[model samples]
Target: MTRTLSRAACIGGGVIGGGWIARFLLDGTDVAVHDPHPDARRIIGEVLDNARRARARLISAPPVPEGRLSFHDDIAGAVEGAEYIQESVPERLDLKHEVFAAIEAAAAPGALIGSSTSGFKPSELREGATHPERIFVAHPFNPVYLVPLVELVGSGPQDEAILDRAADILARTGMHPLKIRREIDAHIADRLLEAVWRESLWLVKDDIATTQEIDDAIRFGFGLRWAQMGLFETYRIAGGEAGMKHFIDQFGPALKWPWTKLMDVPEMTEELSAKIAAQSDAQSGQHTIRELERIRDDNLIGILHALRANGWGAGETLRAMEERAFAQAHARAAHAAPDPAAPLELHRAKVGGDWLDYNGHMTEFRYLQVFGDATDAFLGHIGMDADYRAQGLSVYTVETHIRHLAETGAGANLTVRTTLLGFDAKRIRLHHEMVDGAGTVQATAEHMLMHVDTQAGRACPMGAPLTERLAALAPGQSALPAPDHAGRPIRDIGWPLGEPA
Candidate 1:
């Protein structure tokens, strides 16, 4: 029997490290923590609780089914044989080198080693390491469990493969991994954000704006747009007629203006620091950091949850999450995969005694048969019926792809979701993801259908009335193909279909 790689190790066990542990464990990966502090386990447990609560807002799916956590007193013991090692110790250069030495010695040679240093560049962190190629910066935002972005930067060729694997694992943990083109201090996002931080510090030091006011400026203004689409793209739309170049041409001269003092560093004088700290305390005296953390979590959940509805970035995260939850629930209930939530109408055949083959599960071809029935039903619902076909109007399947993931044995009741991908004057495209009642995706179908005129027995344009009707149905889905299937096919599967429907 082959064992799944679900265990990971975190070294140092401080705030950020504890967060990495929380994120991994909450995402269904068993985690081991290594920290010399005698209170490491307690601290990590608290962090995980916070992380879990924060994750609650963003993920509506069931809890990650909980995973085991082990505390290792020894660093080598924690890293030994682990598939991935996340090093999140304090960001001191010397300390990172010291820790990496041990990590290199203990972690499996093939294991990816990620250093959670917000300040140190990958080259600098891996300077003295024997496994330089395997060590890279995996800088995550503070409060790692809530934030979805990770900045991956490294120099060596092996770094790409390791980072790609890390991206998969991070996606599993519900994070967005962006691989940086070059090794730079503070990676990508932090660098862009650092400029604002520096200016915010200046404003505070000069008494130009209150912290709350700066926050208000962001929240009430461009912040919301930036959350969905970042700076350049947002600005390009704002540029009007000619787009990006026109906008740049009009605004390029502003770059030379003294609107920003980015190069100016703020002095952390005792008086200035004291004043800032006092103002921060005054601004949030009503709540503790724990309370603020809860608020942040709620906001993240709201924002990401809303985005998930549209199948955006954070929304995709939610879909991925819901799939896992549905999968786990089905496992526990020992039921077959059924239909997930969909906008279109769907139906499924219950698993009968004869549905099971010699392996005691539904066979592969049964998926096609069931889905074919579903397609027929859906087309019938949407003005495509025997009469319409007799008039030379029908849907032709141009392409299909199915995946078998799990087995649905005899006596297992199953359901499916059929979604209208889009429709045009000439053709219709549809997608179906079959899941259990618990919401696990079992199989998916992407179908390209051409409307045919029965009299000519060939493809024909869809009537305006029918197109208008479909517009009322799928809405915006008709404009373009989904991001995953752009310019490629009439239809293609998005999720794996396990066994049978």
Candidate 2:
């Protein structure tokens, strides 16, 4: 199957489907979504809200607006012409089978169908489908829009290639897509999660610890290590330069002891589920889902930013992010102004850590923040400083659009360049570009800012004095060399910030 994607479908508009939308749309793929549940629209809208926040948290530099999201009442409407179909309905086997059947009937022959069921094997999911080979499993963690890992399992002929395609697509979604060798009940990641969960259940059942205690044990301990390097590599280092062989030799014998019950699978009694759910509620009784999502996005951004600082798995993610930011900044800067004498100071700013998202790049809002700062600085330079504002005057951005051309990583030196697009008595239209130390433009902000009176908080005219300064500045202002497509403001999708000749 062709790897290039145009449209994708998320068949369920719940949390998981919303995540799929977040992943694909943030990465620039058009998405069609369907859900029969009465609250699907509201649920997906909530998901999109979370997705916007998630994108802002992880992707430094603004991500392109999600490709058009078409909500459909019928499954066929969502699946038609979609290159990929992600099924994220409830966790019932029968329901998944029915959904897969519908997907098979609706999707084109080339489209790949992915089931987000955590426990079901692909063989079982494909049991009733006509083209079982096109179907597989793509199990993502909760708060799927933020977490990058997706456990992919494929069955039947050419399964490996299908899995590869899925992995590529997930990578484009900024996820760490893992392909397990064969089918298992819960696949590799969840199996690891299950092992810990089962042990946790045993602890809770035996009154050894509470739910939060188990969570603290993992989170405060090995979870930190696992994010950068997997368990085996960490253990190898823990072996003191003896390497994997020596490490295994020294500790392998402990496997025979009663350190863990490796073969145990806990029974999912209602009592156990209720106990877990109750504990979860007790832990987070006051926070709404949106609030929880913001918290998660904040923590993930912090952790990932730290990882990027140390050059971990998040580092690669960061590099990709920085490149993107530079590209967009360059594009926006390029189109903004007509020609000028020297570099225009759009804003002088400080970078914040919160601007770093899960991908360890700058967030979308910060890009505008920086651009706005740059514009303020330029206006100040041209005699629109606070003193000017002290006389009941300031600038307020009324309309703005940002285009993300490349990714930007944490701690990369970036500066904003402003080009005076045009100006009127009451408003100034400007373009701002953020560039890294290496002179790569990552993102651009085009804003329509209105003059305002600080005291009245209402629109005001640019005085004759400020207007003269703007004209003086405008004569010296010039846009950057046009990128490949000069006539259009938007650039090629996912285009790189090319090396300067």
Candidate 3:
């Protein structure tokens, strides 16, 4: 939806790189990927499938058309003509240097190069680079597409501009790009995670808690709080009437109470590794890795939806993305806005797999959703937008009639054709025809929409822009023949004719 790079190159096809590919492609940027693994294509395909499912559920705004995907066997072929190149090979510095060299040789001159290195600083990543300024650290958490936090660490003062540009690009693609002030090993989030990881390993080695117990301690406790508020804000609230200062005063002593073994290095002996692995296997071995990924994605989608509704934390990023998505959809439909003489075809959608009912057809409610979206599109076509709504003016649908004409299935592409039957100073009567890809009418909806002053909670007379626009189109639309079903009400059938008598 946001203006993305013309082309993006991913130098690896493992989990993290594949996630980058998914985000870029779904945001409507052509992606070129290079991965040497024997089964790279299959692995990337699986991740993409999951990403698509997540996108369908998580995004409420109009969908962006998916971009092209191409796989290359070599870095030179992949990075050619790419405006943004991401390196996600193994963590070894030597391997990264080789990859960077190849990328530098073939990538476009002004391409932004980012490394998905968790522990390496940007300076270390740029050690032997030809265009060092273009290279930086863009560390992301696991399941990069859904989680949305991208730690963008730049190496020097010159890198400020580049990192800012990188942040802009990522933010447009529905990510929160946290720009680090300076280069540091392991960056920010991972450093905090490492402390907890070390302490958890100690807790297990001491037999104080099993793997499942430790996970429950986090997931059932502070993990929920951290998802929305993070550490400091949650503690600030715990301060009650006092503030963060009081919280620090109360817990500062705990920092030296030897409550954690964060500084101690646990010898990862074969026995210790096996003990942890076996406990983890027992805890979650019921599901395969793919199944577990899907479960995680679904949970994250729900949480994101809640956060979006509340407009808090990472949800703000999601909100911004949805806004951009709406704007982008409006821009795409700009060309399709018909002359008042012709029926407007401004809304289109493809039924997702999640839209199906138990009967293997599209669910009843989804039909309503499509028609509602179509109505919204028609409103937007005239000039309604966020700024217009901010003036406490909006059109509310007062009545509607629907006729289901045919069964709809998952993945069925639908288009809505709308006609303005009549409009007074305050209200509009509109009709929508929902048709499938084959041009068969699937459903029809008629609605009476009233313009209202939201703050006053009452219907109001129309103003300049809306009144003028409506008047301009009234002649053409009013003169055209109206739908046969227009203004019709539900017909009554006598109880089986003679049965009731």
Candidate 4:
């Protein structure tokens, strides 16, 4: 069996290190960080804040319990007893070598050590290390907490088992780990990005375009396409059903054209540096870094959500993780059994900013959405899980009546409690109450669900096992008085008083 990572040590608390910290902590792994810089704590704190906000928006299911975080003044103390150690020191070979030595001295004997160096090959990073086989490169993208891709590379006489363990941990943390076949100066993605960066710098130095315009060219065009489909796939579509070979043949000669400055390097003189900085400032200097980060996060959330709906690219990753999370939550609920006196509290969510209406409260339709999620939870509890549904029998909502009792604004934490109102062989009635943190009723939904054989496309009786489970709950709920607003017509409030004119 593979060892499960529960605690990790971060050697540097800079941007990349902080991102690693956020990703680990959010995945329920305790983190110990070490950085000699005076402002390390503040920087890491800010990054964690941004990560938490983005995570709340990205994942709709309840998250795992957050892990504890501690800061250390020295690398030895940070890596003490840590099962995994990550070094994110400045991208200098000597600095990384020194940090890795210290980490190897302090971390557990078999601990997997990863370096966040974007350019250095793993062989260079493990040059003077005692445990070179344990060292690998786990380069991650900026905003490591959100971006899923991580490039994993191992150096000289690599231990395949160690790399497999590292990849497993990364995957569990909601990251896609691409194992590099051989050592390279800059791993796959960055090499491609560096090429683009080199060309963009030449464009800026030659005064052909400003920073903003270059960004616009990408964002408004291929960037959106690349979000879900990569360069080859996008161009394949452009081939108009002929496929990638056709695209290559059609545009193959253009590759030789001097459209890009790939080989030539731009001199970054003080004049050019100042010009670039000023132009960048002019382009986006109005917002503070935090504000810009929020804007970026919002845009990413929208894009990821759209992709998730289509189940493509990064969206596909998000959807798979969410299903695993929901299944884990369901399993935990089953083990702890619901309290008979109170409605089963199985689902909780924070109102996301996108859920708010123009009036600044949660929209009406979202009430039904929350209730629907809660009902799904109830279905899972009574054995109507994904596996059960796969047998071609499942429950489907036939009718829903929602009553909005109070308004709740964005960021308000809401809990859903579901009560079984009644059930027969073919139908089950459920009442769901949505309450704020203070237990105030924010909304209520009464739903009727029909058990159906999806293959037959008609109502059907639930399995004997599920029926027995519901029968146990029906009696306890039967003793309770009916809700005051259980049955109400959708009509004018004063219809009887006004009468027909």
Candidate 5:
């Protein structure tokens, strides 16, 4: 199993399959998709579009160049020479068996085949297959492009190395692959989800709550808690410092109190189906499915970003991936020298829809965030890297003045340029310009940074390495005139206070 997977085959192009394609492609793996659905291309395109937008907003580090995507009408054509193959056809066992048989015939001997089946066990999916060892369930949550969790189930005499290879491949695509210890009907997460889902259905069947109400109860309450910390850990906190044992002792009795109808399932009669459908429609029918998807992606991005900031759960995964991306970008840039004629163009990003305000323009705080990232890049380029900070020496921003020159909207591509204005041992002044794709300035920022001995909590002289690099950049940038917006006083007007009146 190579760390660098070049090509992958997707055997379906519905929601889950498209997500697999989007995740693979975004992570720089070329994808070949095979699907017989007439609307496969259109559905996958929509998913990819949402994926691209969400990914841009979710991570700030330089993205890997997206891999080429090609659609194939036949499974053999798609799976040929593919290092990895993911099957996401309908949930029917016979259909999956047919698809797996076709894939096994054409797929390379070493290629790992993963099925996106939520309900079927890996043993069942591998039944009657030539290479059952290579066939396993790699179940993923909906909108798989954004969610990081992928359940990996492998329970056969097949090569153990093959299972490890599958995990490696999924990790490379920015997923947290949880290996199932044993084969189960639905595998861990879905089983837990099914229990809750059954309860929610019972509530609707009893007319105690509508679909939206059930959703609201989850999203507004435990869902937020679950996102960051799972059930047991959350309950551990509920023990009031006594710990899990105490909490379980207190709440364990309630488990048998018949609070939930976990053993019972509501019959999906026509009346119940129509009731659920009508309620769902009335709750969310204002938006089309595509619109709802965008909304979901946007909300997920916000939640993930917050988690990333805190380095919790899925956020931890995202942060790790971002650090890897940043390091890779820096490594690539290290091979090339910065051009003296141009300001260092190291940071690039697209304005996310979440950054917009009521006026439909990028808000103020994001401007500073972009500038800060550019500054960090400049620091990394000048030998002020993680090791430098780890040694208790770093530069801290002391002052900043930002000037908004032009309005930029969501999805606008942005490029940042960092100019060394002035520098000495103790402090450095920098000017950053945020420009759009057309090379028009959207905003400008002037920052003064103080070199600090972080442990001492005071300003300190920078090391010779950083000083030398700054000296090199300063001379070239000094030849250019000071920006007109620099050093402008914060005032209502430049003239005398009463002159206009």
Candidate 6:
């Protein structure tokens, strides 16, 4: 089944739970939410709006139809038919236990339960529970829809299957499911965060740095390194010809030196809290919370795109998701029997804000990207796939001519209507019309393609279904009227000799 997430229930719809909801729904999972907060619906709606914008920019895959969103009066109603349940209520032992009881009472049998607790252990959350084995920690970072990591922890060895299943479900939704080996008080990331937080508080309390200055230290320095490579991995490079052991040997003793006050947490007096709050306000007071979130989302998208180019770290995860999305699209197309007689519509996509340039229309390069994707979709329509390419035969673009017909704005839903101009044994001449949702032509491209034996690095005749499929479609496609500019090149606009000389 392609549906990894059929239904998900969120017990709380604050920032974290709201993110979980958006992540699930945008991945095409129906979600039911329960929160007693009077403004629960509005809060979730606002978060969903932000998530929608971020996803449009962050992911280029035409999003699957969003899953249905519903709010329930109580937790029981929310968890009724849910296959996955995430709890993100306020942190407390008794409250969690009570919620777990309510959830387990009505949740489907064997449905997975994950707690978003930052401090409580799985063992603690499992206490007095009906299905204690099902409960585990699925803690995520803030702005959870965009940040992919969900630190998964179980109490002991009993949850290997549960962990694997949970990880699979998360991976399908484009999340990196990191399984923790053992249960600790706050799990892995939060523990590390606590250490950093303690040191930062001390820095602030001693007036060593203002909030902005402290933030600058991170944003300008190791934070970038930490993003793609974590602490030890980044430091291994710091060893310079030597490795981790050498770096540790050189810098390990510094750990023993009294250069930090990690153990001694500063007292949380009224004065210190006020000082920290005032400094934070002064530093970022110009932007509202939502505005800051948008900036962060944009920055994260840039970083992710960079990492994806290199195929390292989180970028690898993103690439895998993109591959999966494309494969799914191809699969759906393959299953369908679209009329080969008509203009074959194999691909469509929405123009997100990221696709726009300074002129507020889709950028120049993205048009080619869209046409290229449509070309792939066409190849897939004729049964080209990874398996076929593995045989060292593939299609390559030899030449292309594009005419920008109209300026398309952001949020325009684009559909590529492809026509087969002509074809030979080794060459396929194709034409593509890029149209917006309203049927206006935004652009058109004429491409000459050559099938090649990848290993031989030369043109080759296509075999089997590809040729057969093309022959089958040629009858109808060949009869269609050709565009006047199909074989034309850019018009020469040489300046008049006398104008400037």
Predicted model with the maximum lDDT: 6
TM-scores, all candidates, are 0.66, 0.68, 0.88, 0.92, 0.86, 0.93
lDDT of candidates 1 onward, in order: 0.73, 0.75, 0.88, 0.86, 0.88, 0.89
- Clashes (backbone N, CA, C under 3 Å), per candidate, total 15, 37, 0, 0, 0, 0
lDDT of candidate 2 over 196-234, digit per residue (tens): 877888887676888988888878999888978988889
Steric clash pairs (candidate 4): none
Predicted candidate 6 versus true structure: per-residue lDDT over 238-328, tens digit per residue: 9988798899999999988998777899999999999999999999999999999899989998998899999989899888877777666
Worst ten in a row by lDDT for model 4: 327-336
Deviating ranges (above 4 Å) for candidate 6: 1-3, 390-392, 463-465, 491-501
Error of 4 at 80 (Å): 3.4
How does residue 371 of candidate 4 score in lDDT?
Answer: 89
Ranking by lDDT: 6, 3, 5, 4, 2, 1
Any runs in candidate 3 off by more than 4 Å, and if so which? 1-3, 337-345, 353-365, 380-398, 403-413, 424-427, 435-442, 451-485, 489-501
Q: What's the residue-level lDDT of 241 in candidate 2?
A: 75
Q: Judged by lDDT relative to the true structure, which candidate is superior, 2 or 6?
A: 6
Steric clash pairs (candidate 5): none
Query: What's the CA RMSD for each of the models?
Result: 15.9, 15.9, 3.7, 2.8, 3.6, 2.6
Name the candidate, 4 or 6, with the larger TM-score value: 6
> Which 10 successive residues of model 6 have the least lDDT summed?
492-501
**Candidate 4 TM-score to native:** 0.92
TM-score computed on alpha carbons, candidate 2: 0.68
Whose TM-score is greatest here? 6
The reply for model 4, stretches above 4 Å from the true place, is 1-4, 156-158, 383-393, 453-459, 464-468, 489-501
Q: lDDT per residue, candidate 1, 1-501, as tens digits?
A: 112348889997777888788888887777888898878778877787778656644543335466788888788888877898899988699988998998888888888888888878888987878878888888888678877788888885657777887787777776778899888778778788999989998998889988888888898898998988789889999899789999999999999998887989889899889988888887887998778877777777778778878888667766776665544432332222222233453455555444457787887777787677566656545555434555667678877766665776665556666667767788887876677766666677777788877678788898644566566666544443453532354344444554332
Q: Tens digit of lDDT per residue, candidate 5, span 43-147?
A: 899899999988888888777789999999899999999999999999999999999999999999989999999999988998999978889889998899999
Alpha-carbon error at 494 in model 1, in Å? Answer: 50
The residue-by-residue lDDT of candidate 4 on 1-501, one tens digit each, is 223469999989887899999999987889999999999989999999999989988887667678899999889999998988888999889888888888887888978899898999988887988978899999999888888889999864445778899998888787888899888999899999998899999999988999999999999988889888988889989988888899999999999999988889888899989999999999999999889988988898889899899988888878876776666566555555877656889888889888999999999888877888788778767777667778999899999999898989988899998888899999999999999999999999999999999999999999955797798888777777778778665766565677752
